[model samples]
Target: MSTAKDPGKGAEKAHGKPSAKTPAKPAEGLPAKILSKILPPAEAPKEPGEEEGEVPHRETAPAEHGPGPDLRRLTEIARALNSEPELRHLLDLILDRIVDITGAERAFLILRNPEGKLEVRASRSLDREEVKKPTAKVSRSILVQAEKSGRPVLTTNATQDPRFAGSDSVAYMKLRAVVCIPMIMRGRSVGLLYLDHRFEEGAFQGVDLGLLEAFGAQAAIALENARLLQENRVRQAELERSKEKVEELNRVLREKVRRQSAELDQVKQVLRERHGEMKLKYAYPEMIGRSRRHLDLLRLLDRVIDTQVTVLIHGESGSGKELVARAIHYQGARKDAPFVSENCSAIPETLLESELFGYMRGAFTGADRDRKGLFEQASGGTLFLDEIGDMPPEMQSKLLRVLESGKVRPVGGKDLISVNVRVLAASHQDLRKLVEAGRFREDLFYRLAVITVEVPPLRDRREDVPLLVERFLDAFAAESGGPRREVAEEAMALLSDYDWPGNVRELRNEVFRACALSEKVILTEILSPQIRERAVPRSLPARLDDRPLKDLVRDSVEFVERRAIQEALARTQWVKTETARILGISRPTLDAKIQQYGLEKQG
Candidate 1:
């Protein structure tokens, strides 16, 4: 036998002799370069009967049979088995490698079941019909003995081998050669790698057994790794399914909560409407009255309540102008619709146009969305514009156009929207006087005054004072949770004769004060000084008796100053800022005078 050598280190030179020291790399066209790196190349093929020193000829393995596994091929088969991550493919690959590496005619990869039976996991050269055969029964006894011993077993001629002399399968199948290797993992034998040749004896060699045993060990590791991978994949799939189920449950709960919240909001809106109706019924219980003047006023309201007439109400400040407007709206045909009211004097002249006619989005700063004005909101209803005389001259022209055409143009809008609103205007100022003075438009006044309703002052309706007093006492008692205050005969007489500059509103305020300060009785002492002082004037002397002339003039001047300050305070409802404005004095001067006069607040 010749020794193996690296083919890349040229053994022969151009001179037809073997080179001694210089080593040249193999030609790039050669396939044996990879094999050279793993192991020495096999010795060149020798001719028949050649001597040991004779030069050998290069030859390839015959096509009819596979060659034994070289060192390079064994490593390649091991890498291929380890690379496969799936258990099924790896098993087949292991069996294919066994057949190629050992030059066997058939190969079988057998695994031990839990019951200790050898089952065929993968096989080459076995037909599908024959694959069902029991591996332990068909395999010679030597395979079992080798697996138990945890080593490889080889036979050149199994039928006649001493180790398997009486083996039934060896004798019946006439097997000539066989190689069996145990697949060991973690110090235990799990299965066997089996190979056999029936066509030729000695087809597998000792060197081939070593390669098969090495490949068997690698196959075991590969199979275990693939099993772990499959288990991990199954666990991830279960977790994903569980996560999806939780998300679906959360979405269902949120939708249920949203529906419940909507139901609660609808209930709240219904409660608010019920409360407003209750308040209106309690405050205006059949229009508290007992006089013919009050009866005539209600009759006038009845005639205009059913029509679409534009009614103008003329009354002094605090004279129930808004009350008359509310009575007309709540008793009218459009009572179910909105009864939107705006005080023209309360809003600035610059913002009055937008307040009455609405505006588009981005009409000015802070206007982020389109808004509906009082006119549009009061469609199919009544739009009560209080203090209409205080509306700017420029806005008056626009109001006239809207009232005439029954259409309103919103601020910065190109379209006109039709409105079916009934306008009710009120003011303390005389609109006809304002028109004559060039401060108000004549056309707008005519549009508003189609029907005129004048609310009488409290002085003209003295017969209604006792009824108004009883109503205010009961209303205030219920609101304050106290006993109703009874008015004394003298207090009632004093309140009746007083010229109420503030009208019924002032009388109600006086009664409310008495209810807070008195005990079960509205006495004369609890009445406002304006009402008390009115009674004193009826008894004033025309001439002083036994008094100095200078002293009388000074006392009269002091009395007149005190009375003037009291009237100014009552007009402003005791607000220092407004009282100072009406009295044409600074707030400091008004404060000094209020202290110096020793005036006590009654209402």
Candidate 2:
């Protein structure tokens, strides 16, 4: 018996002669050098006992009636095996082809795992159906011998052969015609090809072993190629998943940056608003008056000062509405622009249009050259229109159009001029009443009164009277270049007690007159007669005889209570909390007293 050699090394001779070459066409799809190693040349000399075109049968096995191995079929099978790249499918293909070529009852392709353990990768029967429980069908002893020696193990009759007689699988299954070929790659056994026939002793011959050894070499290469391709596919899938994760992270980062930028811009805007508020609080010293009403007006002015909304100032004549307008113009964003003022009542109806919107040079009686009007002059600044309630109905319509369109047509000019002016209108008369009586256009009134600022008259904030008096006294001294005159206590009391009907203007005029006449101290004698009349002490009731003692006492108590509550209300500026605190009473009790005494806050 001849020993089996490694299929990858070379094919060995059987029975002391070279194995007869299978006569068929040349192979394809493999390199010629590799094909030469796997297939015998067609022109080789025939064996002595072998006839032309006939396979030689060995002495240990009976002669077969089957034809010789077909070279063309083997080449086709090699091409088919190499073309398959998927590992699982290629393994089944290898086993199926082995069963067909060797005429074995069953075939198994066993491979080594990463841990170097033998595993049955595929199994096929002669019927071309898959065999289950392939591990039980394979001979473990044969597989070990083939792998260790790195050679093919062939037994014509495994049960009788001493080499495999002690194998449990061979004894139990009575295996015969067994062959185990080691699939070697790069001089290392990667796995083994196992085939067996259970019934016949010479089912596989020397000719079959030679053909299988050659086929095994091609199969090993195919198996290695398939395993590498599968690994590459798994790695490619992992890379795609990683790329998507990176893109998602970048998107989240961009969104976070955008939100942070917006929040920063909001913080900057808040800081700017706070800065503007600080400027309003300390910048205007002439706003004058610490009364709650005056403070409330200042707050309202601060709110509207930075905005470009039209403001309508509502107050009685000489209450200083124009002063409030000037404060807004000078202390606001448009402080660098011009401030133009006009009195709608002062200009006559015939000349008002030309005064407000300038006429073209040759269009009027005394026209000399084109002149810009108040609206044009006040561009990019503030325009104060005093006594707007007295504006004629026709002129009011034109003013409303200009204010809405932001463009005004001059008296005789054909083109409409655009003006970026912020308008502030003032009126002592109530525009609401004028609108109701049809003396003013309702639409125009609403348009002008986008924001309304009410300037309190001097009488409403009587607590400011002392401060105003001191200011006026200082002004008179500065103007006359004389020693500053001081008013007597009684005279100041009389001035505070008497309500000034003509408001601050009348008060200033009276102070000026007193300062002019007095030498060092201003007294009641120098004050106006109307103010002096209030200085006369009120006389007590001449007779208390008509009412009972208890009744009279009750009446006096009520009068004192009423006076006390009234004084408290005035001192606290009608703020119930302060009024109650000063009177040492609860808020509910103070409210009750105020209601009972018919005490109401005066405007």
Candidate 3:
């Protein structure tokens, strides 16, 4: 239904109803008849004193072809453009204008398709069948003039023009004059708005073209916005996939650690039962020592196979507490299962629970879906909790429950699912003292203390210094694909002498430093200066010639190595983490060495 005033008013005025008269000049090439119908009728002079020469305002500028109407009309158009955001609503308004002004009896707004053909996007007095009939493509001839000239085009007869083929279905409705206005953007017309006159009284006037050109401009803007929005949506979807990959990486790291831990436990027990000289064949026992302190740790590992009780491994920060944990899990019954690990102190308390137990969909506003907690992901595997002392107090209760009941309850979920898993806990804190001071839970402490294994510091097992250094050098060479770098006998001795506060972790870093900066075969000033400058337990040798150079270097290296190992062990609780840190190796490496050296069986 038309919303504007009836066009019957035009007929009444033409039939000599006392309407106002107009005397406006039409633009070049515009028919004077167009100016007559579109311009407002001039009114009689109000009084003799009034300015008589002033031309009456032509709200619909039939002559100028400028923007039609005045501020109020433009404002209304702008409001409509703003209020109706959807493209469908905007299309409806445009087609209605074409039918009302250009006298199109039945009209449609066709859009270009992916194949570059026209398809009717919306219509007036038309259904999908009429649109999809395949003839809906506007005649190429009709589009040529306006597209080439960048102006309005008029066709007097539809049957004559080759664009609208005369067919039985199309012939039923009369199509006379077509007034096509180019839809222009960036000075180029992208599409067309067309109208037809089905009756003699409905011929298009110049004012109709002016109105259509403005509407066409508006329609183009709406369409461009819709296309850009779709592109952005596609890009956002791609970014989400990349985020999922990072989550996958984190999951894989935990799974690897769990599997290795369970395997170590198995290896530990097998050695005890067979006991043929109790010679251990840990992954990397070749480059090293023949010390009873070093070998005892391996013996203890053999005794503790099949035990899922808490194992609190203590050592200095650089000590291989984490390494021992790995060895225990990897060599144990859970070898086939996941060896998941959590760095208790890394994540904040606020996020720790959600990260550990997972969350339900809508657990919090931005959570779009439910997630599997880490505990569930590591079910039937060993969970290595590192930095256990640093865990938030609030989460401690939950940890205790899981250990006691072997079940995990994710946040925002009701079901308490049982997990067949072993817990391997490690920390640098003195849990006994912490418990006495009411800082740590005594009950939780007892549960984890079931099979406590103290790792001996590196200083106590000076016999392993030569072994650790040799292993580190080879490992670095293999991984870097670079020729192996070695330490001078003197540099080795100096390294072993310092009281290493940073422990085995410090040793690994120093070795990496030597590898990173070592230009010559032997790491000299670039490496030795660091170890040489630090305070040695014994005074510095006065001259290299005083003792056998090899012995002198070995003593220096062992002294520093022992001191560093001792510091790390104290920090970690006599854990092989000290050796792991000294060698700049992984916890699993240290664990394997701990068993090989038999440190676990040492007094």
Candidate 3 has its poorest 10 consecutive residues by lDDT at: 58-67
Question: How large is the C-alpha RMSD of every model relative to the true structure?
Answer: 25.3, 18.0, 25.6
* Best first by lDDT, ranked: 2, 1, 3
Which candidate number has the best TM-score? Answer: 2
Clashes of each: 0, 0, 67
Pairs in steric clash, model 2:
none
Q: What is the lDDT for 255 in model 3?
A: 89
Model 2, 70: alpha-carbon shift in Å? Answer: 5.6
Ranking by TM-score: 2, 3, 1
**Candidate 1, after superposition: displacement of residue 466 in Å?**
0.9
Regions of candidate 1 where Cα sits further than 4 Å from its true position? 1-286, 536-603
- Better candidate by lDDT, 1 or 3: 1
Overall local distance difference test of candidate 3? 0.61
Clashes of 2: 0
Candidate 2 per-residue C-alpha lDDT over 1-603 given as tens digits, one digit per residue, 9 for 90 to 100: 234334423322322233455445555444333334334433333455656654333212221221124456667777898899999899989988888777889889999889989999888888988788888988888888988876578887888888875789788887878888888777777789999888887677633444565577779889989988998998888888888888888889899998999889656644543344323452556766754467678888988898899999999887889989999999899999999999999999988888887788987888889988899999999999999998999999899999889998888889999999999999999999999999999999999999999998775555466678888998999999999998775676577655676778888999999999998889889998998885332222123645577545644554456557767877788899999999999998887566543445643
Cα deviation of 339, candidate 2, in Å: 4.6
Number of clashes found in candidate 3: 67
